[model samples]
Target: MLSICLIFFYILLIISLTLFYFSMFFMFNDLVLFIEWDLVSLNSSSLVMTILLDWMSLLFMSFVLFISCMVILYSDEYMYGDLYMNRFIMLVLMFVLSMMLLIISPNLISILLGWDGLGLVSYCLVIYYQNVKSYNAGMLTALSNRIGDVALLMAIAWMLNYGSWNYVFYLESMKGHFEMQFISWMIVLAAMTKSAQIPFSSWLPAAMAAPTPVSALVHSSTLVTAGVYLLIRFNNLFINTNLSKLLLLFSVLTMFMAGLGANFEYDLKKIIALSTLSQLGLMMSILSLGYPNLAFFHLLTHALFKALLFMCAGSIIHNMKNNQDIRGMGAITLSMPLTTSCMNVANLALCGMPFLAGFYSKDLILEMISLDFLNILIYFLYFLSTGLTVCYTFRLIYFSMSGLSNSMSLNSISDEYYIMLKGMMGLLFLAIMGGSMLSWLIMVTPMMICLPFYMKMMALLVSIIGGYMGYEIFKYKLSWELFLLKNYFLSNFIGSMWFMPYLSTVGMNYYILNMSYKIIKTIDQGWNEYFGGQSIFYYSKNISLLNQMIQNNDLKVHFYLFVIFIILILMLMLI
Candidate 1:
C-alpha cells in the first residue's frame, strides 16, 4: 500500500524528469516564452500574472522538484508515526509550490508572492516542533526575512517610475540610469537578507531548530537559494557598476565568517547550516563577479549535496534519539556505513575535491577570480574562506566518523532505514556526477584559463594544509590543555559566530525590550492604573456608592452638602 508521501514523491519525480529534459531542449534551441495575463489596469499601472519559460528557470524548477520529491520521500521515514505528519507533508509541498512560483515568475509582484510564501512557510516549518527553542528560531528567521520583504516592497513602489513591475523587460534599458539605481539598491538589499549574507546570516544557523527534512529542503536549497536565484536574474543591474563590487565585499565576508564559524560548531545540523551559508556566500560572490551562469551552476550542485548531507545528518540525529552533538557521535561508520559514506561524499564535494560536483563550479569561480583585477582583500578572503571550508569539513568528519564511540552501549544506530537511504542514494549519484553534467550543458562556450603556476595550485595547496591542520586541531581539542579552557574568550567568540547571534537577538532587543518593560511598568501598571482604568473604576464606584446612600435616605450627608451650598450662595449675595 502506498502512503501519501510516496504518492507525491512518484508524481513529482516524473514531473522533475520531464522538466529536466524540456529544459535541455530549450537550452539547446535558445528558446524563451512568456505568458502574461493582465488582470487589472489603473491609469498608468496594471496587475499582471507573468509566467516565464526559459532554460534557466526550467532547469532550476526541475532541480527543485527533484530535491523536493526526495525530501518528501525521506520525510516519510524520518517523520514516521508523528501525529502531525500530514501537516508536515503539506507544509513541505507548499514550500515546493512557492519555490516553483518563484522560479517561474519574472514579475516583481509575482516574485513577492513567492518570496513571502517561502518566508511564511519556512517560519511555520521552523516552529513546527512547538518548543520554546523552535519558537525563537522561527521568530528570528521570520523577522530577518521581513527586512528583505520590505526591500522588495520598496522596489515595487520605486518601479512605478517605469510604469511596469516586470523587471525582466527593463534590465537592459535601465543600465547606467542613475535615477533608477535606487531600485537596484533595493533589489540587492532584498537579495542579501534572503540569501543570509553577513548581517542577515545569523538566522540560517538558528533556523536549524526546524525539522531535518525542512533543513534539507528549505535551508539547504529552495528558501535560502531564492535570493541567489533572484540575483542571478537581476545580474544585468550590476554591469559596469560598483554595486557588484560592494556585493562582492559583503558576500566574501559572509563566506569567511560562515566558514570560520562552522569549524567551531559542534551540532551536526548547524554545522551543515553554516556550511550552506558559506556556499550561499560563494554563489553570491561569483554572481557579483558577473558570472551568473557560474553561480547558477554551483547553486544546482550545492543543492544536491547539501540536501543529501542534511538527510544523512537527519538519519543520524533520529537514530541517536535526537542527539545532535558531534562529540557524542564518534565511530558512526561502524554502524551506518551507507549514511556515513554519503555524508563523507557530501563533505568532500563541499571541499571541492577533484571532479566532484563542487569542484567544477567552485574551482572555476576561484580561477576566474584569479584572472580578474580584484583587490588583494577580495583574493585573500576568497582563498582563506576556501581553506576554512576544508578545515571545518574535515573537523566534522573526524568528530563524527573517525573516533571511539562516545554514545552509550545501548544505542541502536544503523542504516536499516531503507526509505531514508533510498532518498540519500538518489542524491548521492547526482552529488558525484551533477557538476560535470551541469558544466557541459550550461557552459556553451568553455572558459579559457590563464594563470601563474603558483596561483593555479593555490586551491589545492590550501586544501592540503587545511586538512592537516584540521587533524591537528582535532587532537588539540582532545588534549589535556583544552584550548577552550586556556583561551575561553577567543574560542567562545569564534564558536558563538562572532556574537552575531547575540547581536541579532539580545543585543538588538535589550534596549528596546528594556524600554518596553519600563513603559509597561510606568504606563500600563503605574500611571495608567492610577489615572486611567483604575481611577475611572474607583471614581465610578465611589459615585455609585454615594447615589446608593442618597437613595437609602442617608440625611446626614445630604443635609451637610445642602447647608454648605446655602452658606456659599448667601456669602456671594452679601459681597
Candidate 2:
C-alpha cells in the first residue's frame, strides 16, 4: 500500500514539474521579469531581461527529476520494510521541491533560501537512522554548512544594503560597488564551502553515513551543485573580479586533494564521496573560466552519471547484505550482471571514456584550461586528478565485482534490484550520448565556439590510459604512503573536523555550568550567613520591647512635667 502511494505521489510531482517547465516554454519572456515589490511606478516591466534559455536548465532539470523519480521507485523496494520509509519519502519530496525552486529562482534571495532549504533537508536525510554515527555526520554537515551560510548571509546583507534587493537594482547599483571586494570574497568563501572546496570539504566524506539514495541525490545532483549554480547565476558579478582567479586556484587545489583522497579510500562510499568533491572542483574550474553554459552542461551530465553510479553502489551493497567493504567480495560480476553492467557504464562516464557524457564535458573543461594559459599547475592538477579518478573508479569496480574470493558465497541479485540497476544504466547511456548531440547542435554551428578538437582527443586518450593503469595497479600491494597519508592525515583531518563540535560544545558547556555552580554556591553561602541561621523572632521581640520602653518613659516624663507645672501655676496665682 505504501509503495502504491509513493508511486502516485511521484507521478503527481512529475506532472507538476512538467507543467511548470511547459509553462516556462510558453511564457519564456516572463522568466526575465524582475518584479520589484517596493516600486509602483518606476518601469513596471521586468527588472532583468535575458534570453538565456537553452538546453542547459532544461537538460539539467530533466535528468534531476528523472533520477529523483527513479530513486523514489527504487527506494520503494530497497526500503520496503523499513519503519521510516514514509518519512524518507517525505524528505525526498521536500528535497526535490527545494531543488526545483532553486532552478527557477530569479534573484539571489530566492536562490539562497533554496540553498539553505536543501542543506537542511539533506542533513535531515543524512541522520535519518538517528544513530550516533549518523547523527555525528548530520551535525558535521550542519556545522560546515553553517559556515557557508554565514558567508552567504553576509553577502546578501551587503548586497541589500549597498547594491540592490531586486535584479534591476543590482545591475544599476553594481557599477559603483567595486569597493565591495570583501563581499565578493565572502561569496567565494560561501561557494567553496557549499561545493566542498578545501579545508571546508571534510564534511562530505563523513556524510557517507547517509543512505545511498540520499547520497545519490545530495552528493551528485542537488546539494553540492547549489554552489556551482550560485556562481553561474551571478556570472555578471564575477566576470572581471580577482575572485574568479581565486576560484580557479581553489578549484584546482580541491581537485588534487579530493582526488588523492579518493585514490586512497578503500570504502566504496568514501571513494564516491571524494570523487563527488573532485568532480565539483572540476565544475568550479570550468565556471571560473567564464563558461557558465559549459559548466551547466557539465553539471547536467555529471548529475546523470554520478547519480547512476551511486545507485549502482547502493544496489551492490544491498545485494551483499549491507557489507560495504569492497575487499569482502569478488568475482560476482557473473552473478550480478545488471549491477556489473551499470557500474561499468558509470565508470566509463566517470573516467571520461570516449563517447561517454563525461568525455564531452570534461574534455571541454580541460580544453578551456589549456587555452586560457591560466597556469601550468592547473593543467597538471587537472590531469593528475583525472588519473586518480580513473584509478579509484576501476578500484571500486574491480574489488566490488571482479577477482576471486574463496570465502564469499555469491547471492543472486533480485529482479527488483536488476530493474533499478538497469534503469540507472539506461539513463547513463542516454547522458553519454547527450553531450555529443548537444555539441553538434549547439557547439559546431557557432563559429565563436572555442573548444579544441585536439584537446578533446587527447583527454580521451589519457582517460583510456588511466583506466588501464588503474586496472594494472590494483593487483599490487596497497601503497604505504597512501595508507599513512589517508589513515593518518586525510582521514584524521576529516574525522577531527567531524569531532570539533562535540569537543567544543561539551567543553564550553562544562565551563559555563561550572561557572554557574560557583556563582550559585557563593550566593548560597552568603544567604546562609545572612538569613538562614538568624533568630528573626528574637530580633522582632527585642525591637518591640525597646519601642514600648521608650513610649512608657515619654508618658512618665509628660505626667511629671504636668504635675510640676500645675503646682507652680497654683503657687503663682496665690502669690
Candidate 3:
C-alpha cells in the first residue's frame, strides 16, 4: 500500500511541476481556479471552499510535493525496521495534503480547515517515536500552535464586519478601516506561531525528537513557510500600520537570537533547526518591510537546500548509531565522502556563498533593505545576522566534518548510502540552481542595486570574521572549555534555548496544572461527594428503615401504624 501511495504521489508531483513551469512562462494574469460549494448562506453572505491558483501557490505546492516524495522514498531505509511503517508514510502524506490545502485557499473559513489540519497532523508526526522526549516536544508543538489557531478563529469573527468570509476580496479596500486592525494583529500572531518566530521558537529545536525525514520536511521547509506564505498572500493589508512596524522590530530580534543560539548549539539536527528559525525570522522581517516577493524567493531557495541538508544529516546520524551530538563525530570525510560533500555544499549555500541558491535571494534581500528608510540599529542587525549564519555554518562544518574523531570504537560508517543519496540528488541540483532559476522566472524586472563600496562588502566582511571565529572555537578545544566555564550562567541560558522549554512546559504547568488539580478536587471530591453520593446514600438508608417499620410482623405495631394513618386522613377530610 505504501509503495502504491508513493507511485500516486510521484505522478501528482510530475503534473504539478510541469504545470507550474508552464504557467510561469505563459500565464500573464492571475490564473485562478476556484470551486464554490454553497454549504451555507446567512445575511446575504456566502461560505465557500475555494481553490485559488496563481503562479505562487502552484510553485509552492510543487516544492512541497517534491520534498514529500523524496522523504517517502528515503523512509524506505530510514524507517526500515519500524512496526508501523505504513502509518508513518500516511502521516507524511496527510501533512503534505494539508499544506496543499493551505496554499490554495482564499477563503478565511476554508483556510482555517487547512490551518488546523496542519496543527493536528504535525502533532501526530512529532510523537511518532512515542517516547518521553517526543511526548514533551509534541505537547509543546501542539499547545504553541493552538494559540495561533484560536487567534485565527477570532480573526474570522472579526472579518464578519466586512460581510464576507473570503478575506481576499476586501484586503485592498479594507486596509484603512480601523475596525479591522485586530484582524491584522491576530494574523501576525498566528504567523509567529507557525513560523516558530521568537517565543514560538524553542519548539522547532525540541521537535528534533522526530525522525530526520520529518525534521527535513516539516521543520526545514513546508510547515515553517506556511506562515510566511500567508503573510505574503496578505501583504497588501499590512501597509501603513503600526502593527507591521512592531512586527518588523521583534522579528529582527528573533533573527539575531536564533543566530546566537545556533552558534552555541552542538546537536547536528538542532543546529539545523535553529538555522531554520533564523531564516524564518529573515523572511518575516522582509515581509514586514513590504517586500513579500523577496521573502518568497528566499523561502523557496532555502527550502531546497535546507531539505537536502537534513537528508545529509539523517544519513550521517543513521550511520553513527543515531548519536546527534556533533562533538561525538569527526573524520567521516574519509569514510562518507559523498554525504560529506553534500553537507558542505548545503552549509556553504546557507552562508549565501556567491551564486548558490541562498545567494540569489539572501544577497538581494540585504541589499534592498539597506536602501529602505531605516535607523542605524536595524541596518546593523541585518548584516550581523547574515554573519552569524556564516559563523554557525562554518562552526558546524569544522566540527562535524573536519574536527577530531571522538566517536566510540564501535561506531562504523556504513556503506549503505545508496537510497539516502538517491533521495537527496534531486534537491541537490535545485539547491545549486533553484535560486537563479526562480529569480529569473519570478522577478520580471531586476532592480539596479547601487551602493557604496563599504556597504556592498558589508555582508562579506562580517561573514569572513564569523567563519574565522567558528574555526578557532572548534579547532582549539581549550576555547570551548574556557568559554563555557567562564560564561557558565549565560552560556547555559542560551544553550538551553534561553530556558524557553522549561518556561513553556514546567514553569507554565506548575500553576496551571496546580489549578487544574484544585478544580478536580473541588468538583470530584468536595461538592460532588457531599451533594451527590453522600446525600443519596443517607436518603436511601432512611427510606429503607421506614419501610422496615411499616412491614413489621408484630400485630400491635401494625395496628398502631394503621391507626395513625387513618387519623391523619380523617383530619384532612374534616379540613
| Best-fitting candidate, scored by lDDT | 1
lDDT of each: 0.91, 0.72, 0.85
How far is 477's C-alpha from truth in model 1 (Å)? 2.4
Q: Rank the candidate models, highest lDDT first.
A: 1, 3, 2
Q: lDDT: which is higher, 2 or 3?
A: 3
Candidate 2, 472-551: lDDT as tens digits: 77766466447656578556554343343344345537788998898777766566545654556668879998777757
CA displacement after TM-score superposition, residue 153 of candidate 2 (Å): 1.9
RMSD of 1: 4.2
What TM-scores do the predictions have? Answer: 0.90, 0.77, 0.87
Cα deviation of 109, candidate 2, in Å: 2.8
- Model 2, C-alpha of 461: deviation from truth (Å): 3.9
lDDT of 1 by residue, 370-395 (tens): 99888999999999999999999999
Query: What lDDT does model 3 reach?
Result: 0.85
lDDT of 2: 0.72
Please identify which of the two predictions, 1 or 3, would achieve the higher TM-score against the true structure.
1
